[model samples]
Target: MDTLCFHDGNITDLIESRTLDVRYDINHNLQMHSSLIRRLSQERELEGHLGCVNAVAWNSKGSLLISGSDDTRINIWSYSSRELLHSIETGHSANIFCTKFVPETSDELVVSGAGDAEVRLFNLSRLKGRGPEENAISPSGVFQCHSKRVKKLAVEVGNPNVVWSASEDGTLRQHDFREGASCPPGGSSRQECRNVLLDLRCGAKKSLADPPKQSLALKSCDISSTRPHLLLVGGSDAFARLYDRRMLPPLSSCRKKLSPPPCVNYFCPMHLSDHGRSSLHLTHVTFSPNGEEVLLSYSGEHVYLMDVNHAGGSAMQYTSADASKVMSFAPIVNGVELQSSASSGFPSGSLKSNVAATLDKCRKLVQIAEKSLKEGTNYFHGIEACNEVLDGHGRLIGPMLMHECLCIRAALLLKRKWKNDAHMAIRDCHRARRIDSSSFRALYLLSEALSQVSSMIFIVIGYLAIYDWQHDAKMTY
Candidate 1:
């Protein structure tokens, strides 16, 4: 899908088409289409870019299209007619890499990120429809956030006042439009324009021996539409980190004290070749519109579609391996780490005494199993202990903990190549989903199980065909 290309001025529309059961009216301009529409491409031309267009976005109403280019310019076009409506030279010193139309705003505002390590917001109220490029539309406000180039921008869906920017400086910073406007000209406000800041360096607090200048340059980031507060950041270090809004520091903290390091509650590594731990780069990270799947693009060469519900597993990695290649599924997180994060939302006092004790025992067993799996020592005993904990005390644990345990068991079964045991593992996955329908990791594991079953069926059919061919030759001879 990434190989899809468009000529200068052309826009691609993705639609799904299912015959017989569904119908859509083309006269409605493709908006009132049926749910069956899937990845069908339609093109429209809106040519005004003079250089390589770096970024493009459609407003909430689909009435306006905006593009940012290497020419240090932003162009607005009519979505229906392909006519150039307005062009504004962004007074930035570098090329623009990302742009977004801020949603939930009465005024049409566009936020852009560029090589200057700043995020700028441009107001488009006066120039909605076609006209001569009138008095230039100046940026309403500018956010001097990162020390390096800002690579991506994700607007808070319902909150027009907030915007998030990911940059090469190893940080994800939030820019609040309200703060930029709140400060008086002469006040001592350090966070006058900028908002919350998140540190993306993994384990910097624990790794005292590592160099202070280690590279954690970020390239892409996305906010989950399903969980708007959840943000995902990934890049050169190849670890995709997920942050919860509630875990972030308060706005006042930025003004009064040294900023605390951003806490990353969960992370999964990108499956990229490590040219000695410094070469892999994550080009893009986006959540599926429904927020169940995470699509990760790696250096323009590989696209990995992971089921976020599974907590820790790479479901599919689409590379140059084959046009329709299927990679084996592997779970990423173990029982201990997965459950610890998932269950963190609930308060400690809420659990009964027995329940708390059961949870503790489960955590200890998971830790032992994880160590055994890593060191290849006491492997069978660790697997047995995990199963024992699940059997004896699974019901005592919460939905999130159970989900994590099921994933660990399923992963262990996959490693052992136990076909019959995997059915039980699949059953456990379904049970975990039943426990919590909102669990993204559960859905991921279910999808992987289905895929693994499909692959086995294909292998069986191929083997049968080979056997039949040999039998026929023997009889003929």
Candidate 2:
């Protein structure tokens, strides 16, 4: 969380260590806890990539690390051994920009997007007996869809067969590999892949320069983990746009839906230059695991974590100012103690059910608060529940759980437009931070509340200064 860039130079891959909690499989009846740890303490670094690592991804179980680099190569590293398992030559003509493992499949398959305007799918199944010397492996399928560099690649959790790629060609193309692989050109033969589902170009006529040089090119795109239908996009236009995937279904549904329009639901400007819009591209726009917040990285020198519920409502910005080191981020996991409780390291009776019960109750309360706000009603019940967790007049809760409660309350208050009860929200955010400074969500909420308060003060001072200047001018007259 503190250091933006873990590796020197540009970070191509920034994935946190995500592991599957086996408790779900152990106890089918109980709901499994999938807590995400956003900031990772550097365990060790494995030097393998010869050039700038373009992208890094962990397999479904977080056992393997697959990384593609500007070196026109892909390296597969073993997570357990902390050693390079195999190095693959992708044979791409340009720098790799994005890479991801195909989830939900038993086969070891990986997909990579590159500057060559192509998405290459490789089969690493043959990596078992192969030694380090026999690491070379060719891609099983190569699809050349984009005319320019493919900047980002995303796959839907519900349907991993469907893949989305954002390109600098000013277009986002959805490709479905379920049909089959694309036939090789000329005398060669391979399975024919499905045609593009949708190719959307952001035709917003906002120019980055005085005289426009090219069309708006998308740099980053991510699908919300919680809300699969929500897609966040950002790019050369310096704006983060959120699109509803439901509206932009496959091409086959066009006739059925009769076309309601598929551009974007809402857009927030990243760079607001007083004179004119600065040409700072939105490098990244990613949703948190819960889909409640969005983390945005700008090309210039800033990172922002905003409550997705308040994207359009508030003028406040929670900017995490940093240099070029701000590129990738690991997802933050909430309720670490809850995760630890499920582990065998802790005794069975000391925790588990008691904490789980409390956490679940708090989660439901948070949901109730969200639901109330969405209905445009008072969230008294939700607020009361949050107070119970925080105040705990007679009840006793651990620091970790208490911190989580504060975060939930602060987020709810923030969504209600913290400016109305700015003091209360700020106090809660501060208290959360004080309880656990390591809580990124708490810190982020605090920054948001503080920014709003600062804006109000600045506005008041500006008015007062103007009044004083007017009086002085009148006296001189």
Candidate 3:
């Protein structure tokens, strides 16, 4: 199979699958012209699991890549060689939901959360060897903290021992390293008292809520590099909240309002649907290497790139026009600024610089979307309007719109009696549209009900056709 690799914003090479792990030095020309920088082909075929890949992390040196699969296995690969480094098999008994590399560690360790309601830590230092034949190591320590599946994990940049994890159980906890213990402190130790960060669920019964509904669930989280004392979290609720780690009782209650940090200001996909569910499954959140920006990715097939600084005390800047729920994104370290101009039918220059202009455009589209839903006309038009804004400032608000558009379209189609088609369309449309819709997307899903009615109509039409044919045959006889 032929594969393309992107590096530093360039499509430098196209290689065959047999090449597995390969590296290339991308040139300025490639970076200037392409959206992707490097590509590699693999000789060995890798299997894809039922669910999408949730997280991919590179080792400290970027020589290795660790991918966490819903299939419950963490596959390690040589980034340059593309060879299977080692596979660590036992983190959770169920699907391994998320994985992250511990910053500044020579000995590679991965913390994983899964459906088993456990967060397991694996140590790779002793297992380092040349071939796949090397014995895989078991988890060095297991933290059975979360009452539900763990969804997000973050290791403080300079502090490996201080890690934060979020789970479906509606809780976030902080864990630190133990001086002499093999595992970190507050790690499953019988004596240690764990630090509880926040409980946003307000003690709702788990049975009343759905597990897959991450919009209500604490979907994802990340810690700030500049202010290590702050943590950011997002969930089924439409908003992302910021918390102060220094507060004496971390979980007692969040401060009424501590001007939100740079990353907390934007609207997320989870906020766009009325089902009280996020149309997109928010998978991961991270801060840029410079700590000047924040990156968010969602299952809605959209990715958001935003400036953290624009999140003024109360006003949040966001753009939904250009980003799509991206499987993964790595910053381009070297590349020419990709230019845009009004002549090309796109707003000129980088949309990253103009937050207000971008937000204005998105707000207009949102208004159109709301109107379309109320009137039940020009559903596609509403979607297209949203798309136009997404094309302009996708990095800021694309995911939210994409997911909302999907749910809205599905509802519309169902209303038209396009049952099977509506079902299929809902999946495809949601996969394509990535943006925030202020929770309107899920409410517009009346299309699903419409589809059921349409199905019955089709059945009646089919019976009439068969009866007419029989009557004609009898007359001829």
The digit string of per-residue lDDT tens for model 2 on 367-433 reads 6655665675665545656665454311334556666666767766766663344546766765565
Which regions of candidate 1 fall more than 4 Å away from where they truly are?
1-42, 128-132, 181-194, 201-213, 251-277, 311-477
* Regions of candidate 2 where Cα sits further than 4 Å from its true position: 1-41, 183-202, 205-214, 249-264, 267-275, 310-477
| lDDT tens digits, residue span 96-166, model 1 | 99988888875378888899877888887856563645636778887774668888988767778888888
lDDT of 3 by residue, 287-340 (tens): 766566667665544565555666431223433321242112222223311222
Evaluated at residue 34, the lDDT of candidate 1 is 33
lDDT of 2: 0.61
lDDT of the structure predicted as candidate 3? 0.54
